[model samples]
Target: MDKQGANMTTNTRIYLRASTDQQNASRAEASLLEFANLHKLNVVHTFIENESGASLERPELFKLIAASKQGDILLCESTDRLTRLSNEAWDTLKQSINEKGIRLVMLDLPTSHINLSNAGDDVTTAIMKAINSMIIDIMAAMARKDYMQRRERAAQGMAKARAEGKLTGRKVNTVTNDKVIKLLKAGTHSWSEIVDLCGVSRAQVAKLAKVVKAEA
Candidate 1:
């Protein structure tokens, strides 16, 4: 049987993110829904976005936070999905969640899984909160480190290519550009929807929109 808190609400808000439009931000939706169902959590909303986790400018994430009330659970697939922000940004995000009285539950973190269950005695709950906070901080730091390392490696690769005189900038995908133009002309999809459906960045879509407008 699923445990329920007698005095608290199990309201949950799910946040899912992918670093680029090429990745499906809703990839974890089904699994997370299943998890919520298994725990008998009342899923209030699921916010999906293709935004870099390293940045704190994500609109969808903040929307989820704003919609949450005290005792609401902010569920995520993992800590990395929740944050790959710098220490300062991560601290700010944590402050916002803490201030909102939100309980963050990450599926990959076993320590956090207990959060879905009924609350224990006050002392036990406090100890778990401290432990979970420490582990989440460590994981967030590691995620940031990984992001920095990948960026450094990409820079090194670019530098090597420049030195070798093989640094031809990214080639335009005429096929994708044509598709984006068609979608923009259709005037049916939002910028974000086009980004997801066409697997192109917002900048690319905006550029295509300009071309379509000029032709019109």
Candidate 2:
């Protein structure tokens, strides 16, 4: 919390996340709000996500990043909650923070504090800050490695089940039958566009078109 800017409220975006939808969404927020209050942050908006942090398609997080203004602080409960499951994803998130000119403030690590307003003071504080950032990176990497190991184990289990001739996974929607068939015949667009529209692949489109022709 910068005392000079304390009286004048600044834009702050809050991020709250849970491991899964089954978890209590409010738990993250409750703790984060206390942190925000202690820092006197004027929370302009909040992005709450109920999914694994690895997923690139976090709609709320994307919205928050897009909506964030320069000098706006992104407040989170902890770095681990902010990113897990992939080092690549963590890199992407860090890139977003840098490119967006958004300062990230974590409650747990005070040394990770970023003072965008005070450039002269920053040089003196650089070594300590770097050490704290390194600690965070190491912890985040461990969490991501664990997530990958768990995923690999689950995949192996699925493979074993398949070997035993067990059916798995939800069925594809049958409602796309006519639409997919038509798109295959018409071929109105490129393979990429077809994939976007029909939610199928180049191989499926080619196979379907050939089958249709053979039937005709």
Candidate 3:
């Protein structure tokens, strides 16, 4: 009845990500790796990155997809770890995953674990796929909703603070910002390289670069 026997090696790629560089991207790595070992899944690669879940510009995530083939599991700690993208972006991501025939497995989504093994009958597998897809889609939608809600709440808080004369806006970290500006002024490194070096956004570097050029 079970197609994937004891000796069947499942190629699983574990992805760990965080929204910002300050957060440890590998925070979930140990647990996910332990899960893989417990499940006997063969982990062929591990991709980690410090990137926002709001955007689909994560290089490591796309790289993992490119490296995977049909039946290969794209494993992550949770649905939110995979995405907190808006509906359109999430649809795009889902399209890519489906088109590539990659299996999505989340540690929190037990339903998706069914796809990890080839042990079920066709009917059972079909049922599991339907259930898993439905559950994951719901989770993705909720994640997106949560992200939007948090952003809305932040905006509201900012507005309230402004009205109360309590908001001075974000204070520029002169130490970091000046360092980034100096790097840009040096004209020696690329924006991305500067971003990595200074732990600041590309837009921040570009803004500082424009100011420096204007002052010159």
Q: Model 1: residues >4 Å from true position, as ranges?
A: 1-8, 118-121, 169-216
Off by over 4 Å in 3: 1-9, 119-121, 169-216
**How many pairs of residues collide in model 1?**
0
Residue-level error in angstroms, candidate 3, position 39: 0.7
Specify the poorest-scoring 10-residue window by lDDT in model 2: 1-10
TM-score, candidate 3, is: 0.75
Per residue, candidate 2 scores C-alpha lDDT tens digits across 1-216 of 222345544577888777655566457776777777776667777788775666554677778888876677787777766777467778888788779877777777676565323344365577765676688788778767776777799879977987796956756455665667776556576757777887777777666555444320
lDDT of 3 by residue, 114-180 (tens): 8787665688789879889999989998888887888799879977987898968677788999998
lDDT of each: 0.84, 0.68, 0.83
Query: If the candidates were sorted by their lDDT against the true structure, best first, what order would they fall in?
Result: 1, 3, 2
lDDT of 2 at 85: 42
Better of 2 and 3 by TM-score: 3
Pairwise lDDT winner, candidates 2 and 3: 3
> Candidate 3 clashing pairs?
none
Better lDDT candidate (1, 3): 1
lDDT of 3: 0.83
Let me know the TM-score candidate 1 reaches against the reference structure: 0.74
TM-score for each of the candidates: 0.74, 0.62, 0.75
